[model samples]
Target: MNRVKYIFFGILTFSVINLYPQINRVMGMGGLTYAITDIDYSLTPYNFGGNPAWIVVDEEETLLDITPNFQNSWGNYRRMYDSEGAINYGTAFKGVKRLSSKGTFVGFTSYNYEVVRNLYRTLRKDAYTGEAYYMIDTTQGDFRYTGPVVGLTYSWEMFNDLFIGVSGTYQITDGLKQVYTNAQSIFREVSINAGLAYRLSNDFVIASNIKYSDFQETIEAKDVNLLDVEVYNYKGDTYFIGKRGSSVTQKLNKKRFEYRGQVYVKPTEKLSFAIIGNIIPEIAKVLVPQNSLIDVEEVYTDFYTIDIQAKSQYQLFENTLLGLKVGYNNKNGWSNNSKKNLLMWDWNISDFYYGLGTSYKFDFIPMLIGAEFEISSIKADSSKYIDSRFTNVSASNNRIRVGAEYELFEDHFIRAGFNYGNDEVDVLYGGSDVKKLGVSAGFGFRLSSAIYVNANVQYRKVSTEYGGSLSRGGLSSFITLRLNTF
Candidate 1:
């Protein structure tokens, strides 16, 4: 009887219905559709200043979603100032609504709490720096961060063939160290994005987007112990100025602007293509408090970057899909010390990526399978004026992903995926010969006509050639409710 049942199930085809899944369905498929030219059931439209003018044309149903997630990781083969392990927990809320007949409104908010264990050196949120003009200490301790982020977006049809949209976001976080020298940090960021899309015809659309952002972070470290704390203020990778004090404070400020253009073409019902181009410029400044009335400028950096990508998707056969993607990025930056009238460092980096993916829906089974292969190359060059040192490095990385989804019964779906990757060298951590593996599983079920629940779990492991390993895990679940009024 069991053999008969298995044979019967194998003869029938299955389909997955989103009906309002918690996360994007593509994520369950190892993000195979990320570079696909289709926006339906995909989040590609939200990239690069969002080009949100397409929201009204892409989705019509109103939805409200709430998600709670937890993630944890432990690692010893990490960056110089990185944490040994960390825990992160967060919850998010999102809503979409149609305004009258011509406009769409989207709003989202999230809160997160993070615990970083055994962190060392720097007190910056992003430690991927030029190894210049930063303060560091030898003490290792734990840190806690709590933050809230909020955003709003609105899009509308301005004319028969023209659409416009705007969005704004604000984020603030507070971080504190648990051990001496005790440090406290406050970070804030605000950004705005605006875009316009014009439908030249039913088969072609063009869009342009612009974004601006401002960021600030302030850090203060103080020790209550009778002995003064000693720290190093770096001037370059190999040179530093040493200081001993009971208290130290620093501030960082940054501003960035971006411009993007996109063209989307659908020549036929089965073929679609998209191309995007972007330019960004940024400036950052670091300052150290010298006295009650004086603040010294430590370093200033200016950056320029350019990015371009193209993607295409074709429905080769009835149930077979193919996607191709290619992208390139280049960035150049220089850091200077105005007070000392010297150029500290100059850096340049370039990256190239190519990917191919395919998906097939089985005719005689209730399953859809997808696989993707990608390769990337990165090259970096740096020059330090103080030491007259020049260095150049290059690395290559390759990755493979496979995923499958099956329908167990009506309104019930299950998915599983696996990923593997190898990096000749880790650019950020300077690790040689890195290998990573990841596995994920997820399920979705409908509770009623308007409510649905979805959950997923993921695990990953990393190993380096020098006998160092790391393990990470995450779990996420969300409830989505929909309402229709017409």
Candidate 2:
């Protein structure tokens, strides 16, 4: 029971705000980064905001995107406990104008709102037989959290071949409730992006980009009722446990940098070569107090990470594409040692990842098929555990996806896909890994020449290799509408 309380607070302190655009079409392709050709919304070539130099517009245009998503899952505890669910709605606005022959300007903004809720259950395991059993469902009250995000970005060409961009974002979360606890959090971020692209000739183009960002987050929990829990261990002091309301505050700050270089060479009409390389580095610090009553009891954590990747793509027959990617990622962290906390530990983790992707379009019919496969090998320095218990620590996993689209009429399309993957960690009870399988179906319609809408639904399941699984999987659905103005 004490462990559960500690884990709950840890989640509230470490949960990071996600700001990436959730484009359903892109995710249907297994979230393949190396095979991405649509430069307008590709994060691999630039950063979170976008690449200023890559914006392409024939005339002045305004683009709008709206998406709503729903997700629910079970288990995967320590963060999202049992019966977890979320609903999110997001909208983005962008305006691009071709100012002159050598200059272009682009501006964009987006907002997202989400409602998250979950339930917790208690369980017991027999020591002699080592059999697990459930005691009570939702021993604690239902947990809920709500948040909203706002962001703006601007990019303009500074010179003949140089471009500059900047972005800012702010997020606030309210109504955060966990068991008998209530909390709130705030997040802020600012980033700058710069790039240079030069066209050597009509057949070739080379570009490079650099991005940097600073981020900060704060979480506060007040009037937390800790008296009813056994974790408080108040030394049998009834007055302090019953009358006092516990409070906690935590803060986190991070700085990040990224560099990307790309080259595209079109030697002939049916053949082309594309290559990209990326380097990313990040540093972060966290401050958390041991308890609310002690003013001087606190701990500090420092973390650092570095990542590098290279990808290449080849286009053949003008309608078929092949891509390959290789990458390495590493992270190291340390925290101040405290005697009161037995979980104080440091860690070093590293991994290697690789992937392959291919796609083809039939010339005789209006049909397209695409597939992607990826694998990751990870290693971590041994200890009780690092990050979270759900983390696989040292493991290898593989993922694969295939999707197809068919245009039955002039402006209507149908799409379908399937995916399978292995989880990062094995099942706790069975000691065997869990695998996931999913199927998706969707359609698209072109209302007009400038407006398009897409809707997709995915059904997924997670099951253990052996018997006696701990949880069920999730179901997700999303819809997107895009508007273009001339």
RMSD of each: 9.7, 7.7
Best by TM-score: 1
TM-score, candidate number 1: 0.88
TM-score of each: 0.88, 0.72
Enumerate residue pairs that collide in model 2.
none
Candidate 2 local lDDT, 1-486, one digit each (tens): 222222212211222222232346555544444454444333322432245455532223555556656655544432223335445555554455555554455555555555554544321110001011112222444444455555555555566544454445555444344544454455666677666666566566677778788776555545444532221211110111112235545555567787767766667754445556556666544444555553332333445666666566677557887777677877655443233343343555677898998888889999878887889886655222223432224678788888887899987878788888885543222223657687888778899888888777777776653434444566666676766754
lDDT of 1 by residue, 1-486 (tens): 121111111011112222233344555655566433234533233442257777777657787777776778786655556678778777777788888676999888888898988888877765554425656777888889999989888999899988888899999999998677677899999999998899999888889889999998888778867567776777665677777788778888889999988888889988877888899999888888788787777888888989998877788898888888789988877888868878977878788999998888889988888888999998877676765666676889999998888998887888888889997755555555778787877777787787776666767776775433443333433333433332
Please list the residue runs of candidate 1 whose C-alpha ends up more than 4 Å from where it truly belongs after superposition: 1-24, 34-49, 224-230, 243-246, 290-294, 387-389, 466-486
Model 2: CA > 4 A from native: 1-22, 28-44, 47-50, 56-61, 75-83, 89-111, 119-139, 188-212, 224-247, 257-283, 288-297, 338-343, 384-394, 423-432, 465-467
Please report, as a residue range, the 10-residue window in candidate 1 with the lowest summed lDDT: 4-13
Quick one: best lDDT, which candidate?
A: 1
